[model samples]
Target chain A: MTERAIPWPMMALAVVGFAYMLLPIFVVVLAGLTAGEFLTFPPEGLSLRWVAAFLQSEKYLSAFFFSFRLALMTMVVATILGTAAALFLARSNVVGKAALRAFFLSPVVLPGVVVGFALFAFFIYSGMGLSRTIWGLWIGHILYSTPYVIGTVGAALAAYDDSLEEAARSLGASPWRAFRKVTLPNISQGIQAGSIFAFIVSFGQFEVSLFLSAPNAEPLPIAMYNSLRYQFDPSAAAAGIFAITLVIASVLLTNRLVNIRRLLGRQQGQ
Target chain B: MTEATAARATGARLAAPALSRARLTWLLVVPLLVFLTVFFVIPVGLLFATSLNPQTIGQVTVTSDLTLDNYLRFFSRSNYLLATGRSVALGAIVAAVTLVVAYPMAFVIAKTAHPGRNTALLILVLAAMQLDMVIRLYGMMVILGDEGLVNQMLRGIGLIGAESSVQLMYNFLGVVLGLVQFALPFMILTLVGVIRGIDPSLEEAARSLGASRRRAFFRVTLPMSLPGILSGSLLVFALSISSYIVPALMGGFRVGVLPIHIFQQVAEGARFQFGATIAVILFLLSAGAVAIYLRVGARASGGRA
Candidate 1:
């Protein structure tokens, strides 16, 4: 506590940064309540028409369901694959471990666009672009989101003590039984954190789906992007508000359940 | 630290008997290894092959010959090279700016008194991950565009006449602002993780050495945080370079980045070979930058610890 004046410059910088971060969110929330036809700021007036419109539209409703189901499926698959990889890497004295870890984590470093391109080419080459089905979108989402899963689970397992599993084994448990009864519970927080991340990443994906989405199947972000690009409708803003609400709720719920603050704190590098 | 981590790791293996260990390890890693090889490694190799041989670019029989013309064209054209340079320059500047802005913010969050700091970080992190890129870009347009909020506010304030042509959106500044806004959270989050891991005693010792607050912070805190700063900056730069939507939406059609060009080449212009080559270049650049970042982090951590 030096009796110095407040660092006004630094404080101003902080204000600007926070404002920049929050401005879009504020705009979307505000515009969602707009009475106007277009997404004008200082919105013309307050109304719930667009929200009602969004809910009433069948296309939006189906796409929303499709996205939700896909995200959930991606979350489960990614969590399983990622947790398995994390467990293997954490316990294995395997040769070429560093290279293997890098390969597994490469999705994190690769640009989403490049991954989207590669997947597009590979799918086309393999004649897997038959129907642009929900399955294709799910596969792409899993590819993109699995890295975060592996990272979070790996971090959690690193903090985990082996003694617990050993204790289980010494108490007349089989190796599989010990791992099932001991290791899984200890790393549940990681799985929870990874699942949330996998969900959010899969849900928010645009780049991969941009190449992969069919005319019939589109993620919400792609839908929003197309809507905005094609028209200046307030529905985009309404969609944004909905997405933000989901994100905030998901994050808060995960934090409440798993102490995600600590998970994020440990997931710096991963 | 690595030795201790390794020793503890060895204890896990010793938990299982030697007879079943080999089989277990093999089984454990098999799925992961196969998944990576099939989906990731092979695809990247195929991409490289397509880029090398134009015959595979979407079944078009342009040529059966192997050529470096795609790479040469990107380099030989002044506009292409200029866009690449601009992308790098913009990336570097945004990363530097984000770092400078985030350091104080991270320091405040990491060192501040309890509840306020925690709330601030939670909000920042959550807001940062809110993936509404189009709306975010729209908000930016409003703030910076001609008929946007800032201009409206400025005109109301009588800061300048109503006839002023102070264009802000669809330019370098707009693009940079959006890039910085989007990438700043990543840097802050990365730094927060690293900074929180540093022992507070190091700063306390410097403070007790009869040093001024500024001097202590510069000598102790900043040096300790270098690894975080380096890694965060690299990550930010890599993200900025590869970003397509932000630059495309905000930069009008005047300013072209590598990604924007690649998008046009692939989707609009139908130049698959050139587009694949550009994607490869982008991939290489990001990987190279990450490699350099990890090496720097290793050296700095080794030096300090």
Candidate 2:
């Protein structure tokens, strides 16, 4: 038998790939601050003008507000629905559980464009009048994000012990109280993780938003898409910077509460 | 003592009634069903119906003269077929490249004892979430454009002649780069889970059996992790094949993928039925690939059990 050593080649590949993943995102932040009106690489001069521009403009500011509101609504709706689904699948000796689970999680596989098309047509035909409204965007974002919540909460439920709930019940607690005290706290991490994911997905959703977006209710991503299509300007880059900052803040917030690895692990559970 | 015993008996007799499980399940699942049905199921059905409907250009009719013309045109047209083929080809390559890049990274993360590994992984996760399709595409444009980052860097180094620009943007290379960047995270994360789950003793046992390190990984670790490879690759492939934003933004007018064509037909041309047909085809391709992936993944894991 030969002695083993560190695989330097693998390590090198990992570092290079990590750099590749991070490089473009890193560049956007730098490019945003460039004093030039047009995007200049290596940032000829750094200034906060673009950020200021983003702050001052009614369009970008309103879009940012709209996106934030949409994301919050999505997070709340998805979490509640996902929590209910997860509870059923976890606690009940329900028949057709596998099929139901798959059905609920189907959004994960459906292409965003297809989902966008489906919702757009449905909104139009059903006479929902949701097209371009905050709620329409809310529904679209929720459909896109709910699967993550289900996945996360399901993972938490899988890892939880049933006896804990039984014990709570034995202590004169009602079924609802048992869940509130015994189950919710244990699964809160999963819910929080799922919440973060839902927020991000909703925040960055483009395909669904593209179909249903109106000027008044354009999400930041949709706004960026619209801007990029008609023109190339630093405002778009500035918006990109703003999004990146939000992502960083969210990630840091998640990290502060729970391990990111655990969150990711919960997300990928089959 | 007799009174207490009688009280305990009475308490036992007066038990809390169980919640009707059927009612509970219904309450939990009904909202989900309604939401998915309205937003997902019915919409897809509508899309299919709309695509099948027949409509003449410039006529606004709710009822379509049902026909297969749209599907036929998509299949018969050389340009559409070529674009579809290009998309599949590029998607396959991107999937493969992503695996090549991701496996090593996953391996390193799974094997390393570094303190910074967690931070690195976290940063990667956040970065993965941060790069929206539009921003990433725009960033690539700045880098791959005529006076973009790469060209500017090259110019600064005096490697190439001044004022002689390198034309890399609006091509297959630029598009693939953006797609790969977007898709790599899922691959890496999926593969990382697989790598971490592989029994450490198996690799040690292979090493003890006189297998070379690389041979050990290939023969012992890799085969065990085949499920991850299949799932991750399938995800990347499915995603890239149906991708709209990257191709539409970065691929430019020259490099037309199927989704871009679909977008153009519906959004730009108002050929709703024609676009739906293309969308259906794209959807089928994605569905077929996913079904195959799931079957393979099931076999890989199910056979193990």
Q: How many residue pairs clash in each candidate?
A: 0, 0
TM-score per prediction, in order, is 0.90, 0.91
How accurate locally, in lDDT, is each candidate? 0.75, 0.78
Model 1: CA > 4 A from native: A1-9, A39-41, A58-60, A130-132, B1-16, B55-64, B115-120, B160-165, B300-305
Please write out the lDDT profile of model 1 over residues B59-108, one tens digit for every residue. 52234478887788778999888988998998899999888877777665
Query: Taking the tens digit of each residue's C-alpha lDDT, what string does model 2 give over B27-122?
Result: 887788898887788788888877777744533223656888777888899988998899899889999988988888777766654547665675
* Candidate 2: stretches off by over 4 Å: A1-5, A37-42, A170-172, A266-269, B1-19, B58-65, B114-116, B300-305
Per-residue alpha-carbon lDDT of candidate 2 for residues A143-213, written as tens digits (9 for 90 to 100)? 98998788878877777897897778777787788888988899898788778878888888887787788
Interface RMSD over true interface Cα atoms for each candidate: 3.0, 2.4
Give the chain B TM-score for each candidate. 0.85, 0.87
DockQ of 1: 0.47
Among the candidates, what TM-score does chain A have in each?
0.91, 0.91
Prediction 1: B-chain TM-score: 0.85
